[model samples]
Target: MQLLEYISFLLLSSVKFFFFYPVFITKEDYNFLEAMTFGLTAGFIGSSTFIFFGDVMYQFFHRLALKKAITHPPKEKKQRSIKHRRLIVKLRDDYGLWGIAFLAPILITIPLACILATRFYHNKGKILGHFMIAIAFWSALIYIFKSSLIHLIS
Candidate 1:
């Protein structure tokens, strides 16, 4: 049961909600080091999954969508989509990968950040490194301030 919980913690941490899990682990009588290690490991696994497989998965899904497409797209929807795309491009240009890295663990999920980094930066090592750095930073911050976060949550 304990082993399963640890695994669950790792899996949950991989996607998001990692920040809140450390307190749970500590309450389970695990040490801070254990929680930090699991968080770091999960962050790496999550980021790596998207960094390597993101494009392939996206292409596969794209093909699937194309197969079931509507013959004629709505003109108003197309115009709205064009505006959204321009906004996204502008934000991407302004913030770049570092912004994603900084916000990944806290605001953005690891997979999304990794996908964005892989899409725009095209540097696997750099993407992974930045993500790990962000994870490490957040892990340390959260662990140090767990009491405060828990209080705030309550």
Candidate 2:
């Protein structure tokens, strides 16, 4: 029964809501090491899968974008374009990949974060390392809040 619960926890962690689900799984009592292992492993797997194959996904999206562009020509830009671009640049400059990595596992979900990181940042190794750190960090944090999370659930 416990093994089945562990497997279920792993699958649930991989899909989304990586943090809270483990607490949900072990609602009555928390097993710190077990939750950490399963959650971290699932996060790593998701991050690896997306980051490694990002190129293919990128190309696919790029081609689709090109097709859309060719089919429908773009309209004239609004005067606010420059300000918007500046804001984006400023945010990117200030936060960049690390911010995305730190928030990814807990907030944005792993696959989207990995894709965004790979799209903007050129370093696969660094991205993966950041993801590993983020997963570990969030996993530990979630486990630390096991009692509260379980209480909220039940």
Candidate 3:
């Protein structure tokens, strides 16, 4: 029963991590080791997947959009324009790995991350490394906090 629970938790965590970390997991689950592993893997996989498949995903979407447009063109004008390019650049410059791995999940979805990576022309391997590092940092923080809380409570 306990094993099942743990496995369920891990699977849930992984799914949630794919979309958003520090999200699906509850406070009760925040043991030091669990927190560390969750945060690290979540951040790494989430961002790395985004970065690696970013361009490919973008192309796929683009093709889809084109097909859709051909079939049924939208009447409304596009909302997002080139104006935000500078802001994106600034974010890329300032936050870099942290921005993509940590903030991206909060601000945008995995698909969006892939889109942004494509737009920014980020290198696949480098982005993966950055994501992994960011995950490690986030996981470490979670672990430390959980450990402290456990100590206090026990």
Rank candidates, TM-score, best first: 1, 2, 3
Model 1 deviation from native, Cα RMSD in Å: 3.2
Total clashes, candidate 3? 0
TM-score of model 2 relative to the true fold?
0.73
- By lDDT: ranked, best first: 1, 2, 3
Query: Mind sharing the TM-score for model 1?
Result: 0.79
In the range 1-154, model 2's lDDT, one tens digit per residue, is: 9778766766666657465555554673547776677667887778888899978888999999899889997787677988966864564589988788887777777777788788788889999998888888887777777657667888
**Model 3 misplaced stretches (Cα beyond 4 Å):** 1-30, 80-90, 145-154
Model 1 bad stretches (over 4 Å): 18-23, 70-87, 148-154
In model 1, which range of ten residues has the least summed lDDT?
A: 68-77
Give the per-residue lDDT of model 1 (tens digit) for 37-62. Answer: 86788888788888899899878887
lDDT of 1 at 94: 89
lDDT of 1 at 61: 80
lDDT of each: 0.76, 0.76, 0.60
Off by more than 4 A, model 2: 1-12, 18-20, 27-30, 74-88, 149-154
